[model samples]
Target chain A: MLRINTRSVQILGQQISHRRLSELSLLIFMMPALVLVIAFVIVPAAWAILISFTNQSLIGPNARNFSFIGLENYVRLFNDPGFWNSLGTSFIFVFGSAFLGQFVIGFSLALLLKYAGVLSRGIVGGSVLLAWVIPEIVAVYIWASVLNFQSGSANQILLAFGLEKQRWLIDMPLLSIIIVNIWRGTAFTMLLFSAALEAIPDTLYDAASVDGASRWERFRYITLPLIRYTILLDFILITMGTFSVFGMVFAMTGGGPLGRSEIIGVYIYRNAFEYREIGYGSAASVVMLIINLTLALVYLRFTRVEWSAEA
Target chain B: MHRSGNSLLLRLSEYGFYLPILVFFFGPISWLVLASINSDPGSAWQIPEQVTLNNYLQLVTESDLLLWMGNSTTLAVGTMTVTVILATLAAYPLSRVPFPGKGVFMYALLLARVMPITAVIIPIFSLSVQLNLVNTFTGAILILSAMQLPISLWIMKSFVDSIPIELEESAWLDGCNRLTGLIRIVFPLMSPGVAVTGLFAFLAAWGDFLIPLIILRSPTTFPIAMGLYRAFGDQGSVDFGFLTALSVLYSVPSILLYLFARQYLVKGMTAGSVKM
Candidate 1:
């Protein structure tokens, strides 16, 4: 029923040098995904760099016909105080949410959950994960009302405790967004660390105890060293993820309260879409891209080290 | 007796440490749930005098909730189909066949996954405009699928790696072509991998807000996420019932998927990070 010419290349009960899949078919198989990514991701990323030199507008005569304006947008961005403020806000956000809040709390939760009762793990771990799986807008909605001015749960709790109500989004916008981000993100690190912890054998801990090592000493000597790669990978992923957060802050504060909570993502949207300054926005995005690429390169290095060590 | 007392204290401290975290995480989510059923919901978390289904009913009868949900489902399904098909196709070759620069190509994919989507919005927007793909579900689906391709490929490649090549080789010995062997034997065995990839793609495209906001202009094309964002942003007179109900509706699919993929989440997250 089928052609046997290709099969002639392979004899029955005899070994072939390699599998019979052809190179042409493999290339054909890869073409669709390769085209999609190159057309969308790689092309757009490179185009952002090219357009950063132009005086493009979202609408107007310039939209149809724009001329190159080298370094003008970048020069203006570097000179502006607002851009500096946005950059600073973004770093604080990444540092606070990814490093201080999520990493510490998630790591602690994982460590505790290892020895925790079933009930405690069910309640605590369940809540953290529920926060994560909900849509970003839903998280934004929940937090917006939670930090509402007059009738928020936060205020009600404060009043019930006889403390003055603080304006969360307005008075302390930075801290507010940071708290929201940490709440949404802590689940990932917790899961990652829990799996890593579970993989380590009980014998390692038993050996440490037999050597008379203290709890802290055992963690330092064994746990940290074993999970170091996981820790590095987690940092790389979360940091980039946090850097790209836009919709939550965009809907909540619009990077307002006098631009106090304007992260870089919101700033790009504001400049490009809201203000119709595509060229300027492109310049800002180029800076953010550089930062992300740098992080990715560092990630590659760590992973490469692991790959070579495996060999 | 002394050792027993010390162990009891240790247990007490462990629960004590967990108590605050549980409270911090659950308090707000509990409020969201409670507010949804309250007849007259407010910002403050409180029990309603009597529970009512009026909010959910209003969403079904009055608003464009169904339309938005329909659009969201279309986008999600489209994305899932495209991402899964392409990823599976690409992964088969990568798993079995050796190609030039394969290692470099894999690392490039890792970079693509971590590259910030927000940073490339300008060109993506303009490209869509040029292609006349603006405001089209096809455009949005294509873009979303591209975004999800990197990690999905890794997941699929690893899955394909687990299925021994001998099974396929044996099929070939029976005069089966590679495509037929794949469709008949290999795919059935890798359904779990396909499910994982499909689930991730669905969750992503369903819950995404940014792509819809940029691509779609009309309310007719809005997804549930866009609806939720618009309703909640109306500061004139807050519709707590409707907003809370929509939130519940919006999260249902995600929560269902999470429940289904509970065992796979850890594996899914580490797919690209861990060496195969």
Candidate 2:
């Protein structure tokens, strides 16, 4: 009995060592990705935070000799009306396109497609996806041409209706970008909601109907409750994405006609590359990061509360 | 009879709802195609007196469009390959191994996705300069892969998690090691996920405008997006015909990719949204 007990203990020790070796091997597997992320994302982001406190520049006198300015850039950022204006513009852009436009229209489209025939589904799905699949630059160009002052198709259509041609990009640049963004982004929301809606069992709706519930009531009680998580997820993603939307707006209006469409992203790029104020740009970026992080935290908290309540 | 009529009305309203969407989505693209072929450059919206392929011919002959496309393809393929391999390697351990600080790694991935690219571009730029990697395809690929890695890792990890570990364990029982099991047993099942991840990585790297814009200085290394932007800048408001033609050509690959992989693309893209 004593010999058996000693033998079993030796076997347990071997098992422990084997597990440790495997764990170490697993760490090896994780090393490449960890190195890449740390090298590229983590390190650069940390450096950006450091650079924000200093007077860095891409060109001019500060290019060679830059020193730490210690919150001066942040102070300048707060006092700058352009920064405030860009933030306001970002808010409006996010609210208008992502929240109001994409959510409403995409949800409506998803609900519509739910009942539509196969042919309509194919056509509508294909058409909406075309907008999404095309490159951002190409989409911007398409919109640019369509909204051009002289020979734009939009004005042509208006002319056919005996209406006046409006200078879209010049007169109402912000509104124009909002509309363009809505057009570009609604497809994603639609696809997301469509998938969510599909996951809802039809049996619930049938039971609700049998219980004398109206279509709206059924949707409110059953569909809404079931897909609330999906809606939240969509809102979080689209908000963050729209907040950083640069390429399309830049290509279309260059955030122009007096910075009317200068969203935060465009503001950062303009400061960083065009004006060559790398430090100020980094400051703005840091602020933007804070805003995004706050938004993410808020949503995460909301989801957590929701999940805990359910549990 | 009333229910049937109600259903008909619903269908008609659905069609009505679809009309505007169809127009909104397709109108710009259709107009672009029409304008590309229109003989008169001055009036892009006008009915063409004669449709011509001259614009396309001019684009190819006058510009370095082909070269730019080649560069774009190389950047995209390189980014996709690197991102996939790294993501897969990392995802396996993440899914299978029990380690302290695992949650930290996951959160780091999430934070990477949440943080805007602008937040890091400055340091990345300066770092690239310091490393003397500026204007190189390697630099662009590295940066793009890094930017795309978090999402790819998240996606690949989800895929790996969905796969049963029991299958791998069964392989282990068959006298196979973990690496061997992953390669032979797990990889085959994860192909769908990998394919989707690859497609996304390819699309993202292919369509990226900002990273390439900053990193690549030489015109020779310009991707299609940069090439188009340069062409637009050079030509300005004139040459609508050539510009539209270039736009159409620029859109062809992505459009073709969408047409081919719409099902997988939709499924894969939405999978993360719903799951998360």
Candidate 3:
């Protein structure tokens, strides 16, 4: 019995060492990715957080002798009307373009495609995707031209019906961006929902219809519940994406006539680079990060419930 | 006859519903095309009396358009190569090998994805200045690849997970090691996933505007996005024809790539969400 125990112990020790060897090798394999991510993303993010507590500037007297001023920038941010306005604009943009416009329209289109023939699906899907695949700068330029004050295609169409031409960018800056964002972004939501919709078995719908269910009833009971997770996922992704949008809005309006179109991203850029207030900008960035993290946490909690229920 | 007539009416209504969407989607692109070729810039909205390609010619010859295209190509290709190689290497072990703190590592990748570039730009900008890496292709490539790593890793990990372990184990029994087994067996199986991930990385790097706008100040170093923005700033509202022409030229590469690789793109895009 003693000899057998010793042999078993030796085998177990070898097995454990082999496993450790493999783990070490795996770590080595992961080294490059880990190094790059740490160097570029993790380090810089930490540095930015630190800088947020200081009175740093890109230029002027503070450029040479900036000192720590803990929480002052955050306090200034809370009192600053510009920061508040930008936050408000961000929420409006996210709600308008992401929630109401993209989600509703894209899901509706996906539902519409379910009933349509293949030819119709191909054409409609292709068209919407064209807007999505074009580079952001190019898309912005195209939309800018279409919304040009005079001789623009939009005004031309409006005037053809004898409606007065309004200065789109100036008169309704936020709305114009919201519309353009909807156009550019709907395709992603459409595709996501389309994939989700296709996953539901047709037998469920067939059985419902056989039982004398109405179209609306079938959708309400069967489709929405089936796609609830997908809708949550899309909400989280699109909200984050739209919140980070800068190039599109910048090119379209440069945050516009008064800062009416200045979302958080543009606001940060304007402060950091344009106004040379690095510390103030970092403070805004920290706030933006916190808000995003909070939103994600709330949505993640909802998703967790869904996950547990499904499991 | 009554059922057929009902079906026909349904189909007609569906087509009608699609009309507005189609027009909205295509109208701007069609207008840009028209403006690009129109001889008379003043009558941009009207039918052209004569078609011309002078605007495109001038864009290539007079401006820094070609140089920007070169820069964009280098950035995109470099990003794709680095992202694919590093992501695949990292993903293979994460999927196949179990380790302590693995869950934490995976969560970190997700957190990285959630963190916006805007939040970190200040420090990254200052750091790049300190390192004297501003305006360098290597700097853009490194940052872009890092930014792209999380998604690429996620996608590749899923792909690697889908592959059966027995295949590699059999290769091991045949006197091959893990690296060789991976190269010989797993890579071919995951080629589609790799292609999709690479395509996405390319798209991200190519379409990036803000990074290059911040980092590359010299005209010769500008990517297409910065170049087009500079062009727009220079011309403003004075020359719609030139602007439209540049926009068309700028859009062609990405549009063509999308059309070519859409199947992979869509599959890769939804892989993470659907799996979750």
Model 3 chain A TM-score equals 0.89
Query: Compared to the true structure, candidate 1 yields what TM-score?
Result: 0.95
Candidate 3 local lDDT, A1-311, one digit each (tens): 43545754565465556656764686688889999999888998888888899999988899768999999999999999988999999999999999999988888899899777788888888889989998999888888878887778888989989999979999999999999999999998888888788889999999999999987899999999988888888888888878888889988888987999999989999999999989989999888888877765644444322122111
lDDT of 1 by residue, A1-311 (tens): 86656653455334344344453465688899999999989999999999999999999999989999989999999998999999999999999999998999999999989888798888899999999999999999999999998899989989999999999998999999999999999999999999999998999999999999988998999999999898988898789889988888888888989999999999999999999999999999999999999998987876642232111
Regions of candidate 3 where Cα sits further than 4 Å from its true position: A1-20, A299-311, B1-9, B42-46, B235-237, B274-276
- Summarize candidate 2's per-residue lDDT along B164-203 as a digit string, tens digits: 8768755765657767888899888888767877878888
Over the stretch B138-230, how does candidate 3's per-residue lDDT look in tens digits?
889999999999878878987888898868766765656667888899889988777878888898899989889888888889998998887
- Model 3 residue A46 CA deviation in Å: 1.6
lDDT of each: 0.88, 0.81, 0.83
DockQ (CA atoms), all models:
0.59, 0.48, 0.47
For lDDT, candidate 1 versus 2, the one ahead is 1
Best by DockQ: 1
Q: Which residue pairs in candidate 3 have backbone atoms (N, alpha carbon, C) closer than 3 angstroms, thus clashing?
A: none
Residue A212, candidate 1: Cα error in Å is 3.8
